[model samples]
Target: MTSKRVLVAYGTEHAATAGIAEQIGVTLHEDGLDAVVLPAVVLPADDVDDVRSYDGVVLGGALYAGHWRRKAKRCAERNADHLKHRPVWLFSSGPVDSSAEQHDIPPVRAVAQQMESLAAREHVTFGGSITSHTPGLIAKALVRHGKGGDFRNPERIQTWAHHISAELAALN
Candidate 1:
């Protein structure tokens, strides 16, 4: 089988989002796709970069308050032209509690809306993992307000990755 390269770009806080991105990348690879995980902050500043080389792109961000992190939004905005022409998937990871339901899905944020205009397939909201070990005083405070614990589910992440792989394969 020919290798299909996928870019897993992320905007993260407290490293939780990064871990999720990495797991997605690994899952993609397991499903026979080549995936690279890059932080949104570390991506090249130029809007017109070489991201077109990838067959697909997955952009994930840590949601704070209601919107994605600023860096994540900037990444999408900067690369809007390229992303608009490609298969893109978006995810927002947050919500500290296990009881969260449909309300956990972020309201249509601007960045997500922009991608959606380009035919992005999905915008998933994954439960976040927060603990006392989360860094920074603000993180701690948020954890208290969020009643944080490990709410992330590995199976859900794996299923999402598999679905993405299946969709891409059908396109191919």
Candidate 2:
């Protein structure tokens, strides 16, 4: 059997989202799949290789003001045709607390809706992190409003990654 390759693409502002994408890629690799982690802004031109080159895709973005970063949105839109035919999963990282999990709702519905046409296997909302060193005035303001700190759960993230690996393995 041929090996499967998965693309773990993400958009991040402060780099936290990039870390998540990298971790997912590592998990996928350890599970016997080839995974590449790349920023949405540089997802390799569809004309060069196309999203069809990958067996599956994991797309994620950092949420701000109840919306995903534009680069992530654009990446999906640019590759919608080929992506629609592959196994896709979506994740959004946001929320100063674990409220997204408790409420069972995405931090940004519009962001989730963007994947409606792709028939994604799952859409997850993970807790986000903010630090005193967060960049930008708006981030500073949000931090001042008690939205700062590390709320992301590494164990939760790993569990989700394992789930993806298992699902892909089953498909293979």
| TM-score to true structure, per model | 0.85, 0.86
Cα lDDT tens digits for candidate 2, 1-172:
5667888888788877777777778777777777754323223222223578788888888888788877677778888889899999988887878785576664376566766877888888888888878788877887899868777777777888899988888895
Q: Which is the leading candidate under TM-score?
A: 2
RMSD of each: 3.4, 3.3
Residue pairs clashing, model 2 = none
Q: What local lDDT score does residue 69 receive in model 1, on the 0 to 100 scale?
A: 72
Q: Which stretches of candidate 1 lie over 4 Å from their true place?
A: 37-49, 99-107, 142-146
For model 2, what is the C-alpha lDDT against the true structure? 0.76
Runs in model 2 deviating more than 4 A are 37-49, 101-103
- For each candidate in the order shown, give its overall lDDT on alpha carbons: 0.75, 0.76
